[model samples]
Target: MKKTVFACDACGYETHKWMGKCPRCSGWDTIKEYKIEKEETQVHEKPLIVNDEDFIEEKIVLGMAEMDRVLGGGLVSGSSILLGGDPGIGKTTLCFEIASKMVELGHNVLYISGEESLKQLSLRKKRLNLQKPFSMLTTNRLEDILHAIRETPYNLVVIDSIQSTYNTSLPMLPGSIGQIKDVSSNLIMEMKRADMAHIFIGHVTKEGVIAGPKILEHMVDTVLYFEGDKMLPYRLLRAIKNRFGPVDEVGIFQMSKQGLISVENPSQFFVSERSNIGSGSTLFPYITGSRPIILEVQAITPKTNFSIPKRISLGYDSNRLFIIIAILEKVLGKPFFDRDVYVNVTGGMKVNETAIDLAVAASILSSYKDINIGKNTCLFGEIGLTGEVRKVVNMELRLKECGRLGINRIFCPQGVEGVDSGVAGMEIIPLKNVKELNSLAFSK
Candidate 1:
């Protein structure tokens, strides 16, 4: 008798013995054992070589500038894109928008939905007011969908959730790790063989990671995540993995009654209602993808009666906030151990960039001291543990975004002295350490 090997589905860590938790990825109960059978060797044939002229480098432009930016300048032929997001987070709307655009450009598109029926899809199409000639197929059988794509002359195929589609021949469930891996591999091979573009909509787990086997992301050419707070109208499309384009690129969209609309000027949209020069408010220019947008960072420090003060952070990393507070106390000899501090990024956008450190520190100190930072001033720089300020990438872009928002004084790292401020009459103030931020703080 032969023993079975267990593999971690999350990270594909394999072992001869099964454990309660995977040591590699620290994922509990993610290891599953499977049987492997020996197969006989078959004859191999020499494959024909193709010429260089057979490969086309030109990409299909998605028409939407924001989406194209995230996709590295449009959709590539024979590429597989996996888009994952929370339910009702505008994934379907964005897919439909893309299909409509492709159809309008005379490209045939086939949209297959395994979750929604034909009538339900028609209602959504009507609501979106899309009159494009793209074909739609509502089916859960993987064989039927594959047959339809083979018979149709479609340039692009959209599978609205590969989890819902199943292989009837396989005994495994539709969304099981083994089933998902098999299905995705088959679809990717089919699309690649046919030299057609395909996009798979994927569901995400509660932890905000894409569901199914981790290899599902690896099997695709691009992995995009549609992220945003449902309470807010703004949505962001980010490509975490892209073989053909920049992975750091992000697309901004605003949900409306009609559908998802591109947010061309995100700076204005984010800072339209920015607070005036007041305590606890600081303007920070954040770079998303290649574009810079000015955002407001707000913090409030109130005396707490509880023995253990609460540290609440919204749209920012709570752990980072605590670290920043500790740095402030160490540098400035100010103790906030007895105070409750709350930090928030105003636009419902999660900012994890180290450049926003200065802004966050300033906002917290301004609130503690009951002083206001200047409304015309904007700042961005990474703060080290020694209280020294560090230079950030694309300083010129951040300054330009601030200039567009009429921000005059900008505090940045020392190396940014030579950046030409795109906004006239703008003053570039350089800071060497976090202690210098005290000079900009308003008096109580």
Candidate 2:
């Protein structure tokens, strides 16, 4: 039987007919029609009892510490990974570097590019000075790419932008919702059958999400976002979803002429440019994945001439900035309502943890009062609406990173369990509330 249905591109909701707005995701005009061919299948396989030792999962180590760390140690064989990032964010460069390393490790790797010609790929390889040789294919035809994969016993396959690939049998253009879904399905099936690792490069939407259907992310074994400010040299590869490893793991890399170089000590690299005497800057220990990193949170509160004060933030949430400002205004009695508050995380790093709440408050207060919170001091704690400082996770880990950086003073929530106040020979100042934060920042 052949039937027609309409599907929502955002959430994959299907209906018998098209609708202007999707009831599931509320996206306007996202529903598109597609025909389905139904066929009957006979069950033939029987369930067999297998021991745990029957299958030993294998990993292909890329020999790059930063890349491996984000990939949960190494790329799991037969797993499909989707890597999304903004254009010129070094997505292709990172993949090429990984391919070269795999070749050096004596792995049969295939570099497929739908977006670039073979000559362009060659030019990039020469420009990046990749010494190792690997197989290269430049066609976007899904059938041809699958045929090549089926013919070769490859250890790894790199698809340079899945959106550019298409199946000719499909009556749609490449990058369309239907085309992306079907192409990814066929490619992933072949990858698993060959038991080889696959890395799919995907383009990100303007909203910073992977383009195409949301199901593409769900279909992959791992989802990694290669993120960094295009203006900055540093890039952060973060694992958003990983079936084989821990989620939220971050790998740091620096963009250079040689390509993406892995950053060994991100803590020192992020704070290397900090000024010793800055009123609006404060050091904060932020946890990304399982590791603790020290980041500089900067805020400037200048009196605004406009009636409504401006609240702007970069690399930090603006709404959270508004809440932090409101808390300071109500709790600490700071006149932030009249000042234009601006907050930023140095080194183009984006921080989402609320553990940085206290640091942000301190920086804003320091800027408002023109006080320096000492460059050697670090502060981290969540702030409540009642002006009380709350505890956060991984206190010891945060403290250790602070100690390693030679920071001697620390401010954190009071009475953290299983953690001594004095750690790493640094003076730990326990803070119970935001009032203590105000006194600590301004008293010095």
Candidate 1 deviation (Cα RMSD)? 4.6
Rate residue 409 of model 2 by lDDT. Answer: 88
List, residue by residue over 1-444, the lDDT tens digit for candidate 2: 777878776666778877999897798987888777777676576899999999889887888999999998898888899999999999999999999998998899999999888999999999899999899999899998989998988988999889999988655667877789999999998788789899999999999999998999999999999998888888999999999999878899999987889998999998998856579999999998888889999998888998999999988888888888888889877776578998988888888898999899989888988998899999999989888999888888898888888999888998754575445567888898999888866875
> Quick one: best lDDT, which candidate?
2
Rate residue 188 of model 1 by lDDT: 90
**CA lDDT of 75 in candidate 1?**
89
Model 1: CA > 4 A from native? 1-54, 275-277
Q: Would you give me the overall lDDT of model 2?
A: 0.88
At residue 376, what lDDT does model 1 achieve?
83
Range of the 10 consecutive residues with the lowest summed lDDT in candidate 2? 416-425
Relative to the true structure, how large is the alpha-carbon lDDT of every model? 0.87, 0.88
Please write out the lDDT profile of model 1 over residues 1-444, one tens digit for every residue: 444678776665678898989898798998888765444676576888999998777688978888999999998978899999999999889999999999998888999999898898889988988888679999878899889978976788999998888877554567766668778898898888888889999999999999888888888999999999899998999999999999888788999988989888888888888655578998999987788988899999999888999899987888888889999999888898799999999877788799999999989988999887778888899999889999999999899888888889888999887788777788888998888877645444
